[model samples]
Target: MAGVNDQRDDRALRADCGSCFGLCCVALPFSASADFAIDKDAGKPCSNLQTDFRCGIHTRLRQSGFPGCTVYDCFGAGQKVSQVTFGGTDWRQAPETASQMFAVFPVVRRLHELLRYLTEALTLHPARALHGELRRLLEETERLTGLGPDALEKLDVATHRQDVNVLLLRTSELVRAEASGTMKDGRKKDRKKDRRGADLVGARLRGADLRGADLRGAYLIAADLTGADLRLADLIGADLRDANLAGADLTGSIFLTQPQLNAAKGDLSTRVPPGLTRPAHWS
Candidate 1:
């Protein structure tokens, strides 16, 4: 039942806005574009953020012309920084700590993203050979997340992510190798569909059969993926920002992360894996 336990833990590690102090809304900046309605600067509280630290347009972010907000997920970093790192202190209550708090938020956010992938990698039975290494990295990453604000602000997240990427690549290869066997003639046809590091920005891929495809690090920005069959596909590090996934099926996709999903557009019919949730803005 390790997989079941892992799924439960995944839920806990997800973005819990209820427990957060609007860190993403305040710490991050966005420019006025098709995705966002207004330009905002880092360290400034979003105009829509309420005194209670909740988005005023939470229920109608898209309608309010702030579709970007609907797709952002802090991956539980907001609450961890606000409650654990800052000792539950609000920025409004202690203005002096605001600068350091904003600086540390993104650092821990990256660490939490790594933890999410490592946790999922551990659940793949085909990658059992690498489970020990995954666990060790997971523990080390988790320890980094528990560091104080000063330590977190000074963390080298890019270096840490580079280290974790090596094991993640191995895990993806192991799991996808088993999936490749289920392809036609067992000839690895999907391997030919590799789109690694390809710039697919706004590509018209509607209804494309991308099952079992290797899409690691693909730039899918604003691509139309409606009705695409993405089952068993490895989407690790894929930039799905603004990608249309209204009717796409991702039920068995491997290495897909919540942040990737959170950045995409999907509807009620879009089938996600077990641990991920459907985006609320989807009609």
Candidate 2:
């Protein structure tokens, strides 16, 4: 029952750029690096942002040296802050509202991210024992997203995120424990997968049975994970930049974020969890 509700919520949590006022372009800062061409400070609109609140080089963001922009997803928080919290008033039109709006954007973005994880957790049948708690946290997180600008600006997002992470960690444990039990008999002996913080850059791991693996904080830059079975794997903070994900199955992957997928290379055959869109660059 809660699973059904989660699927519905998932759609709303996706980024609707057309409905947004380009808050990401103005509210977030980026340092000059391989991912971005130029330095931008918080609250200052990106030089590429046009009068219509759209990226001037949206079609050629990567070519324009703004690859970082391609991976950013606000989880629909931009539009919610623009239309709902501020009542459809844009920061440009009302300059006085700019600071508060900027402050609230990140807070709501974090809440929406937590909601995304909670929604995904609810879908894990193996974690059914924790579904009730996941649903409750999802509801609470959703409520936080609906708070007004003043309340949102005052929110302690870090503390709330810590609280939510506890539930997510528990959910991951339950789901992965089940996955471990189902591993092939021969591989069971070698299933003590704890690769946290491993430097796996450009590693050839095609078709690897990485189910229930702890890949948290692993540096997988340009790694080949083609046809990999990543079910129940914890990908929190894993650097997937330029990684190949063609034919990889990440359906039940835990803590995998849209930005992480966007940073990697994948194809139509790559299977992702619900609510995540395949990267446009993927074949």
Cα RMSD of all models vs. native, in order, equals 2.6, 2.6
Predictions in order: lDDT:
0.85, 0.86
TM per candidate: 0.90, 0.89
By lDDT, who's the top model here?
2
lDDT (Cα, tens digit) per residue for candidate 1, span 192-243: 7778889999999999878767899999999999999988778988999989
TM match of model 1 to true structure: 0.90
Q: Runs in model 1 with CA error above 4 Å?
A: 1-7, 182-188, 267-269
Across 1-283, the per-residue lDDT of candidate 2 in tens digits comes to: 1123333536677888777789999999999999999999999999999999988999999889999999988988888888899999999899999999998998888888888778788877777888898888888898998898889988899998888888887887777775655445544624688888999999999998888788978999999999998887889879999999999999878879989999999999999976677988889
RMSD of candidate 2 to true structure, Å: 2.6
